[model samples]
Target: MRWTVLPLLVLVPLGYVIISAQQSRESGESKQLEAAARHLTFGYYPSSLQQRIYQVPIPYGAAHVGYLETNSWSTSVLYVQFTTTAGGLDTFLAKVGTSRAALRSGSSEISRSQAREASWTFSGPGPWSGTSMHKNGDKPDHAISVDLHDPDAPTVYVVSTVNFRYGFRDS
Candidate 1:
């Protein structure tokens, strides 16, 4: 009887410790996500607007998450951006591909092969512009903004956005 009681005491505390650790881990992840979202400093995203958006699961090894949000329909959009030298984007893409995340459809075709892709015209040191739309089966369209070019020399900034949208338009 004494031995059984002692064992029960040990087991109960061990179980409680395990449960507490799990809860702590989940809490830590939530905090990390909040931190990641707060780190996006794009001028277009103000604190008020930033609060309106939330962070989504990020692919492993991706450098930074620029933006993330979802509409009432559950359609969502995410912007994943990286700043690296001309030779670096390919390496970034390769790492991202290894994570098996679905890169926004047309993004894979945009090569980082040149000092600047002929497809993109550098607008200035800020975000250069372009947009593309994709149709998702039975869902709303997805929009991808063109890679914004950095205005100055050694254009190392690039942004790739994946958007899922759904809504009725007034005819």
Candidate 2:
């Protein structure tokens, strides 16, 4: 009886230690993710994960890229900013289903509210062009603004919104 009881006591503590370690590891991972989700991330090279998740076509050779992502129960928003060469800019525009001609001179389709949400300053370094493309129903919208001060290397800002306003589904 003494031998059996000793083994039981040892096994109980061992099992508890194993389970506690696993729980601690999992908790640490979740905490890191939560902290990352709470802040904006910036990089020269765009994150492929974010690009795929958001369906953003940030062209190759982009510089000074930055992004912020926000989510809710019903909506997700991706804000992207980058600088790209002239050809890269054209490619980006085409991938988003628009052309350079779609951009109107001296105007931005990005709303003040959207810019505020992204913490972006749309009022430029000068000479801006922009476009707003509303895709098919249920698809996200793309509103872009470009500071064409140096046309060869333009600074671009984009706001892509998925889903919709809370409690405002088009059903």
Whose lDDT is greatest here? Answer: 2
Clashes of 1: 8
**Superposing all C-alpha atoms, what RMSD in Å does each candidate have to the true structure?**
11.1, 6.0
Clashing pairs in 1: 124-151, 125-150, 125-151, 125-152, 126-151, 128-148, 128-149, 130-146
What tens-digit string does per-residue lDDT give for candidate 2 at 56-111?
88998898887777878777888888899999999999988898999998987789
TM-score computed on alpha carbons, candidate 1:
0.38
Pairs clashing within candidate 2? none
Kindly report which residue stretches of model 2 are placed more than 4 angstroms away from their true locations once superposed.
1-40, 44-46, 164-171
Most TM-score-accurate candidate: 2
TM-score of each: 0.38, 0.72
For candidate 2, give the lDDT of residue 46: 39
List model 1 lDDT by residue over 1-171, tens digit each.
999999999999999999999999999996566545523333333234432232222223334334433223444433334343433444433433321133342233333432132233334343433333333343223222224343221122233222334333321
Q: Give the range of the ten consecutive residues with the poorest summed lDDT in model 1.
A: 151-160
